[model samples]
Target: MSEALVAAETPGTGIEPVPGVSGARQFWRRLRAQRAALVAAAVVALLILVALGAPLLTAIEGQDPTTYHPSLIDSARGGVPIGSFGGIGGHHWLGVEPQTGRDLFARLVYGARVSLGVAFAATVIQLLVGVVMGIASALGSGWVDQLLSRITDIFVAMPLMIMALALLAIVPSSFPRPVLVTLVIGFIAWGNIAKIVRAQTLTLKGLDYVSAARLSGWGTWRIARRELLPGLAAPIITYAAILMPVNISIEAALSFLGVGVKPPTPSWGQMLTAADVWYQAAPQYLLLPAGSLFVTVLALTVLGDGVRTALDPRAASRLSIGTGRKREAKAAKGETEAGKSASAVGKAATEAGNGTTEAGKEGSA
Candidate 1:
């Protein structure tokens, strides 16, 4: 088929394809059409930047996460901040913590680092373990496949919270809390992805190219790498994007429960733990971390949904906003066309009326 024909046929494929344009460019164009996704992506990017630049940001404000400003808090009033909005003022940006009087803004920015970093690191680990185990289960001999499948089933059956608590409790405090949390979340949470990968790999394993690679005496690893990996990339990426936010929430929950990150390290969840009692007295302290967590999770979720739709445009059915916008655009176009036609008809009718009036006057003359 000609390139023009191929390009013309692609609009029905959910990606607008221009002649000579690569698939990646087409995918990007489709993604850009999702406004919510774009905004969410921007939010996520800003968060990452904030997390990365936390130290500099704190330094610029001449504040650190651990500093105490005793004067900012009212010792007489049960450690409540003296000023309004958690003692927000010139020296304190987001305000000082209730009792310790630590810079809330500084701790918030620093907390972003722990929360984002642990989630990101854990996701990477999960992706690696899931993909490897999934591929292995698919390509292995019958007994090996059975063994791996059973192992995956066991992991899936284990209660995540119980396992996490048990593991976190037994681990020594000498170990870095952030690293421990990441490892716990990553190692325990990969079962779902592994199951997904196994099913996908099995489907791909039966494809003609994969069989041909095997027929050519290629090793299992080589066949998987050369024939199956490309086919698996899209689903893997979509799942991984969706998985990160879940990991983030899990980390936060663990920290809030007092088994995640320790104090002075600055985690959103840990901050929330401390702020629970101060909710009535210092709502800003609670609201700050709570709001941050809510926004982060929401943005990540939207971004993940966008990625899934971008990778497989058929999934755009789930994005009501995108479909709604398309509907509105079509309606607007119809209205515009209708108005233009109505105006043209009116113009023609007025001209005809003028002609008739002129003919009657000529007859009278």
Candidate 2:
């Protein structure tokens, strides 16, 4: 017989080994089981698509972000859109801006490109700096480690928003606003990640495998690349996912404050800045960008949480809980059926004995 068959036929030794799944597969399985998280992932994906294909989408709608249609605005009422819902109609799917009469739909998708792009770019910078600093601090000697630690503490203690505002205000207007915002945010906001990386690196460096690699005379870079990076990836990814939404909000806030992306480039925050005064006259002008920001932030937050849960081996998955509940229900139903069967059997047996007693009495009589 084949070894497989023989093993199957044997007792403990014959049991077939269950194939182990890859980490990515396990993470995806857990993530897919969460309906809200899955929906959020879909929404995030759609937003990305919208951001990437902004030009195409706008072209399809036959609208442009910069072009102003003054005719659509009611001059009598402080430049409110002529029609209801912010002048939403066949020509403008979302509606027009209050005074400019610029297509909101076109600007929205383009704004997504700026907002998400900056967030992603800034996150990349933060991650790179954080991971390097963290690894260096953990792997370095006593003095090296102390220096980096002190620096990290200083950064942690600093007020980030004030620093960002000062830096942004000092920068020359000749510099590109989007790039300036990205650089400022990326450089200033890496302290938390650095701290997290440092803690994780310290813990990981003491593990057996890391020590083994060190004993084997692996260079620092080699050890980091081969031994440490694999261990660091999960936490790094989890943190980055959570950090992106914050970056988006920060970028939006800066723009709303007039320091972010300039006019004509289009940004959600910039749109809000313009729409603030017209909230009552044209609520759609305010609502469109606000709703988009809300949805984007909400989706990102949910997706990030889902990722964290999926990546954490110790965390109980919702899917497992659901399945366990189903199993328990099935067991309870089976027990109930068994109980009914036992009662029916007892009733029949009692009836038989009673009949026998009556028949005996009749015969004796």
Candidate 3:
């Protein structure tokens, strides 16, 4: 019984202790504590799942979204039509479109595919262009940097929307494929990213690691790939997150202007265009797509903010208790050292006083 009690009292003798927290673990622990980041992650995950699984879900309804249904309302009298409001004694949940009588829910689902696809593709292209241009300019001597910087400046000063509009006006409204629109947006948007990447590269190139690599006879490409790129990871991730929303917004705006993703494609922007006439009566039509865009953009912005905070060394330090604990430990060490000095001084003073008194007594004697 006593052995059992001792064994019970002993703290997990067979179990290993938890490992010490690492920098990554500490950062993740801090991030998890943030309520906004948690919520934003959840929302973004849900959106991604919806975007990817849209086709599967739409097929389960036994409805063809692309096919036109002329008498959707009349059909709903017997059975629910694709877009009929569920609780309103109709087969459709969101109500049928007045002109085409298409399913609103189905269209929204399909639209997600278009919006997210374009945003991702454009972001990737922008990153590639920006990273290459920025690194090239940073590695090159004065003339090359100056030329690239001037070109970047020129593009930055130009109105992007105006340029896009002029280009679309000169060319056909419909492109050969969706990729063409994505390429156009990506090519135009890369100027901003190039400037950002250039600035970062300039700062990183002066670091000791970069200098050491150069001193070791590493070429520019090797130095950039090994030394500079690793340092740029945080900013690259942050920039990518922020750029996604911008691309989405640009795609929507172009679509709204009748220059992006031709009609009948079921884009959120195209949905908005269709809802313009019914703005006063059936505001839900406009509100649905607009609301989706607003939420998606807002979610991306929040996620980007979270990523920025997480990636920033200063912000991460502020979030972690490590900084405070380290400061306290340093102060304690300092105090200990001070106490030792005070004790040494007091001992020396006592000894000197004793010696002086003893000498005085001896002289008096």
Candidate 4:
């Protein structure tokens, strides 16, 4: 069998291992080991798929969600009910809204698209701004670092929600598109991430590899990219994962305040708003979207925790140190055995020399 095949078949039989596993494989293995993280990831993926396929699913039932269907009210009044909620039957799995009798399920599915899209876009923007700004501040010394630090402090001190509300109040109505909302949230949310990146950069910039790169005539950008950035992978990924939930919450809050994606554009926050009146009566209306939001947030959080634990170099170093100590102890035993053999050889040589001298003296006599 091939070496690779043999390794695959045999438990713990493989090529010589390194100090740490390869990044991608290690991440996957760690994520899989974390049951909660895996479950959360699955739920998020399923929700995304459902949102993307909403159109096809809605079409199969032969109902137009946007169009007003008065027949639904008649069926509701009759109390016999034609559909799930006396509406359009299986076509509307979540029942119709009381006001317009619109398919709630369809709206919710469409809303998922908006919510996820906005959150993802915002997160990307935040990552870009925060990473760049942080690296710059950390590497730049004296006045530049001080200035950037002060700027970060200013942003961090501001009340984020209130600031968002104020900006929304002044902005034109046409600018409430998903992209715009993402940009707005991203800009404001970068402060915390920037601080994290800055601290990481400061630590990495002083590392031996970074200093070597600088001495080799590499520029600051090159050193940052080649020497510093690789070490930042764990922190960057963990932070990004943690940030997703925060961005989603921000979008939802904005939506709740009537400043988010407008009506007909379905968003989880907007859906929650629409269901507020019926929340006490039909709690499912509120529970559905809220539950989804909760699951997504929880999943990201767990995933972050898994990443943090898996990628922590200090923990890995401690494990390696323990392993090293065992090897050292074995070496010490081998050295002791060699010492005993050497001592015996020396004693035998000494006795042979003494006997030879005695024989010489007897011969002389």
Candidate 5:
């Protein structure tokens, strides 16, 4: 009745069309099917919400993270104060700092803003550059592909950490720290994403939909955008999921090294660095930020793994092999029916000619 239904019903090609669900729907469904990914997603979502709602949370706590509480510090306790590492039930929920009695909870909440923002920004840039370069490399031929491929290879060959350090050295520390860090990390780390995209594009560009678009006089960029891009979504997202934790780690490392986001601007890495010396006095100082980083990275990594496994068609093939076979069998049945109809037509024609001859002979007799 409908064009979509007609198309869905029609079977012309050897490759069977997967019915019912659209690609986006299928991708989401697959993602939902992954239990580990779902849990990781929830954790990541909670982290993001916490990061986004930092100001509100701080306001609710009535604690200014940057404000020093010299009164809260007890000099007799060997720099460990009353509020520092004091159990959860007080005005300072996560306790206060050792020297400067800043609220740890407020600082942690605010620090998440910097960490998530930088990581997400860098990841966005990485995806944009990497996906474009990769698709362009796949679309081009001859010298174009060669040049792009060589450029990607060169980037991959370089020691990215060293390159980032060198680049950061030139940037003024007082410059927009998060933006600079994001650019440096994004520009330096897109090689792996490009490689993954390039390989995926190379495979996808050869598909029937892409070929059909090409034959219908679509420009390279148009075909790439409309035809190849959707197919590349899963891998691109999967790569991105993998890249996020790496980006976060890089930001943390730079902050820990003191070249990253300067003082007064809180970061988990900076907190950890500050807390290192206080480990002997208050273990919570070292544990808080370190534990946060660990959990964030671990959650992201698990999410990535879950996404990879969920989207892997090869892995899922066993479950759907029977359905695939049924499609093949249906196609085969259609062919068999076509052959039977052709044979029936030929037989009927033969019988009609025989009847006509017999009538002519009987009439003549």
Candidate 6:
């Protein structure tokens, strides 16, 4: 068929074809395709479960993380006897602390709770504040952007550790010092997230749909919320996933420095601090909490990478390799159609030539 005929016969829908997949579903599909993501998610989930089931996992009674068994402590050596995690049993599963003889298993489980809780809470705080400030900056006018940008820059440049130390120095020694640390860290860390979200929002606000929404008489709040917010979800969620491990590490560090969750309330950092002195006598004491922290951080880091990859359209294309759209099929179909068309045209011309030649021959005869 002629090009014009093909055009006439083709389906009409002037609008660009939207991809058949919803972003969230596509992201999930991509994540499910990745082995690393599944492994990381499983590890993270296990840690969360251990944290939540802290009490049930450990034997109740004198095994409280804070309750010390001086009898079990080797006073002469200033540490507890060497014990392997593989030897866990009735009284002590993971082992016992070096100097205090507190059940290591109980402390480890309880510590997970404190560390994960603070990290999650702090991340939520930072995410909310960052998203709000970011959207505000994008939706606002010249001076507003300038003011928010300047504020963001100031925080971005500030030293996080020094600021944390200064703030925590005045914080009263309390059972749940994790709360104060979380709030403070979240407040300080929001600036970077705001900057990221603001950049994304600025780009999104200029998109065609945003302008169309505004022209349709939508209010600023409605435009910001309905038009631009959804576009920001992927990056925000990915960044938040990465940031949770950071928050956990920071809380742990603060606890080690003696300004985080106070004594009696176990935290990974505090356990590390307490175990540091008896490393020579019982290496397991130091290694246990440190290993947990390392594993948790590693899992979160992997999960963040997976989430980012899954959410990214370009990255998803790579992961979806053999299972996605069949462009080769479309190419083959085109070639087949072209080959059939060429054969038909050639046959028609040959027949027409034969008919004319026969007519000429008849006239001569």
lDDT of each: 0.87, 0.84, 0.73, 0.72, 0.80, 0.79
Q: Give Cα distance to truth, residue 217, candidate 1, Å.
A: 2.5
TM-score of each: 0.85, 0.82, 0.75, 0.76, 0.78, 0.79
In model 6, residue pairs whose N, Cα or C atoms come closer than 3 Å (at least 3 residues apart or on different chains), thus clashing, are none
Candidate 5 ranges beyond 4 A from true positions:
1-19, 75-78, 84-89, 316-365
Worst 10 residues of 4 by lDDT: 1-10
The prediction achieving the highest TM-score against the true structure is 1
Q: Could you tell which candidate, 1 or 2, scores higher by TM-score? A: 1
Candidate 3 lowest-lDDT run of ten: 1-10
Task: Name the Cα RMSD for model 1.
Answer: 7.1
- On TM-score, who's better, 1 or 6? 1
| Weakest lDDT window of 10 consecutive positions for candidate 5 | 1-10
Evaluate model 4: give its lDDT: 0.72
Error of 5 at 258 (Å): 1.3
**lDDT per residue, candidate 1, 1-365, as tens digits?**
12112223323333555667665776677679888899999999999999999999988889999988898889999899888888888878888999999999999999999999999999999999999999999999999999999999988888888899999999999999999999998998888999998998998888787788889999999988877787788778888889889988999999999999998889999999999999999999999999999999999998989877776765543656666778768877998999999999999999999999999999999
Report model 5's TM-score to 2 decimal places.
0.78
lDDT for each residue of candidate 5 in 1-365, tens digit (9 for 90 to 100): 11111122223323233566565554556567655678989999999999999999889888877998877777787557674254344577888888787888998988889998999999999999999999999889878999999999998888867877787888877788878888988888888889998998898778787788899999999988877777777777778888899888999998898778776788998898788888877888789889999999988987887666555533432223456578768989999999999999999999999999999999999
What lDDT score is found at residue 57 in candidate 1?
A: 91
In model 4, residue pairs whose N, Cα or C atoms come closer than 3 Å (at least 3 residues apart or on different chains), thus clashing, are 83-89
**Deviation in Å, model 4, residue 13 alpha carbon:** 22
lDDT of 4 by residue, 182-223 (tens): 888888878888999899888878878788889999999998
Number of the predicted model whose lDDT against the real structure is largest? 1
Q: Give the alpha carbon lDDT tens digit for every residue of 192-214 in model 2.
A: 89999889889878989889999
Identify the superior model by lDDT, candidate 2 or candidate 3.
2
